[model samples]
Target: MARPENVKFGVLGKNIGYSLSPKIHKAVFEVLGIQAEYDLINFSKTDLSKADIDEIKHQYKGFNVTIPFKEKIMPFLDEVTEDAWKIGAVNTVRVETKGLVGYNTDYIGFRVSLERAFDWPIESAIVLGTGGAAKMAVAVLKDLKVRTIFTVTREKGGILGTQTLSYERLEALCPRTDLLINATPIGSVQYKDQMPISEALLKKQKGVFDMVYVPEKTKLLQLAETLNIPRINGFNMLLIQAVAAESIWLERELDVMALVEAIGPKCK
Candidate 1:
């Protein structure tokens, strides 16, 4: 079958009025010479039902899912890619003849950004949450051959492939962690002045990656920088993931970093 004549794409999530997706994707479509429209569709899980999903399938060619809905949107999908299935979340989805197909571009985005941020290989990492974002981060870290991946959460322990630790245990494990990642929303611009780990503990790690991008410089990343540890914010990850999702919807590959560099100023 041929591609849709006029592709209509957007992102699905709550509190997305500040999303840069519309601008980034619109720029991409222009460069690719494709006719498309990208927008933001904000709504919580309660606001959508089977009927609403059916309406969306009729109205949209594809759309990206974001925070608070990556996992909640799974039941409505007809098919999910292996990576998305393994990660237990879906950030990108397409309306297929059968139904909707889901995929997780977060993995690609995080992995590529990780490569660009670090010259040397990572041996171990401490993922700072067990939510959908953490799952994607853990998946990429494992694929990159990070020998040990420890997941931490506030509640019960033991998640992913490693034992989960509380916030207190980080002090003891920081010495052995090569990379520390914040996959939680604790440090988001919405929830400011929050740091997942203490500055002292963050100093022990060789590097840090924070998955919060709204403020561009999250508290976690700021703390990492204060400690002189090489740190990366999720802004690049955000742009790269949007690029990945567009590639999936277009069914073609584009230069990831080239696109990133092209959209550099806007991303910041």
Candidate 2:
């Protein structure tokens, strides 16, 4: 199908007025010579009902989902990819005449982030939090042949694989952990000045990757830098995943990493 003269897109989530999605998406569309408008569809006022979702599907070509809603938006979507179904989350959605189709580009985003950011071997990793983001983060690590573990508020079993530790137990694996992938939003606006791991544990890691981009340099990444541990932020992950989602939304495969370099300054 030929695209329309002008179309709409958005990032859907709570307290997202600070999101760089609109900048990134609009820049991509402008470069591709497509007329489009992207907005921040915040659901912080009231609950996001099925009716609100139905309305959004009709209003825009597609949209991106963020924290707190990545999993919640799944049931409302018409079709979810096998990977997304397995991950139990949806960060990107495309509006089809049939219905909304959901896909999780977060794994691809994080995978590419690791590929570009880290050049060393990752023998083991501890992913913080067991939420949707952590699931895909763990999935990426498992695919890379890294022994992965999970840390949540409490100990639990059979959650992606055997190994769920409480926050206090995180330091025990510090010696063996090559990478610390913080999939939790602990260092975001809501939890500013807070990180899940101890300074000692953070200093022991070979590297760190924090998936909180809003602050750009989150407290976790800040401490990692203070300790002289090489680190990367989620800003690139944010851009890369938007490219992955665009590939789904616009019906074409664009190079995720290559596009990131091109879409660089526009995100500011």
Candidate 3:
């Protein structure tokens, strides 16, 4: 199919006005000389239904899923790629002639971002939280041959492969953890000052990565900086994922470096 003149795409989530996806994608289209419009669709939890799914499928070219919808939207998809199935989440969806297919570009994004941040191979990592983002991180870590141990909250103990970690356990794990990842929204804008691990734990880590990108340098990264530990923000992951999503939508490979150069100033 030829590219449509009026291409429409969006990022869907609840309270998604804080997202930078639209800006990032719009800039990419503009730089590539493609006529496309990118926007955000904010839907409450109850608003997600078969009707809503059909409406999006009928109207849009593709859309990026986030937050509470990543997992919830899975049931609505006609087919899901292997990675998305393994991760148990869908962050990118396409409206194909056959049906809507779900794919997880988040895993690719996270892996590339982590590798770019640190040239050395990751041997072991402590992933905080067990949400959709954490699942994607786990998939990426597994692909990269990194040993990952999940740290869950005390209340949600015994969450399968996860180990319940109290403040004391975090203190012990921090020193041995080569990569500390905050997959929870603890350091997000609404939940500022809320960190999954204690400051003492961060003090001993070698590197830290946060999936929250709104405030480029999250509290976790700030603490890592103070401790002289190498830290990476989530924007790089977001950028790389956007590229993968665009490739899925356009059915062509894009120059990632060119797209990054076009959106570098804006992403910051």
Candidate 4:
């Protein structure tokens, strides 16, 4: 027998055929014993610009946003949490009578995962890409007291108001970078075996964190492993953030460990 949709939830993104979010959330719901449905609301880049957020509010109680849509979905939201507002990205949205409210848990996830993965002091970091995830990464890195933060993007000039640099500059800055984070989709499932930065540059960092978890070990993390640099994948970050979002949607804290045990393996 199939369960009726007592509660609704999902993720919104473009080209998300490989997303494991459904599995992760479903597992969380199961462990928490909540009857809900999680689905993928796929949209093309062209479609995202003209997204009908009203339809979303009518359909879901809460939802997760991803990729190009993370920042693009903001204008459609009625209110954004302080962290989301500061980061200029919203990965989670809760529907209320006041309209849709946006929140960004990527920062919490990134911060928690880093604390578990490394104990050394981080004075500086080089973050790749300038998307919503990158913004969250920068925020968390700054919170960790990383004074010098550098962002690398393909854009020739400024990106999201951060001091941006071209990929060409990465090689030179890598030596001085204590931590390197890949917040782009460059090493995603579609771009398998691709690295955001060069292997030589990657070797210079004391630690590397790649926010793409689909493959579990992105090429960037693989390169870090080869160089003996401490590396952490995005799986823990994804799980932690997803759990945090669920807590917000349900208005209560969830049994995170139970959900992690159930969905952690599926993320890989």
Predicted model with the maximum TM-score: 2
Q: lDDT (CA) for every model shown?
A: 0.83, 0.83, 0.81, 0.83
RMSD of each: 2.1, 1.9, 2.2, 3.0
Comparing candidate 2 with candidate 3, which one achieves the higher lDDT?
A: 2
lDDT of 3 at 151: 62
Predicted candidate 4 versus true structure: per-residue lDDT over 1-268, tens digit per residue: 2224588999999889898889888888777788999999887663454346878888999999999888888898889988789888999999887889999987778888989898988887888888788888888876777777888888764444356888987776555677888889988987988878887787778888888888878888877888788999888988988998998898886676567767787655
Model 1 stretches with alpha carbons more than 4 Å out: 44-48, 171-175
- Which 10 consecutive residues of model 1 have the lowest summed lDDT? 44-53
**Could you tell me the TM-score of candidate 4?**
0.92
For each candidate in turn, the TM-score is: 0.91, 0.93, 0.91, 0.92
User: Could you tell me which residue pairs clash in candidate 3?
Assistant: none
Better of 1 and 2 by TM-score: 2
Q: Which ten contiguous residues of candidate 4 have the minimum total lDDT?
A: 43-52
For residue 142, give model 3's deviation from the true position in Å: 1.2
RMSD of 1: 2.1
Displacement of residue 178 (Cα, Å) in model 3 is 0.3
* lDDT of prediction 3: 0.81
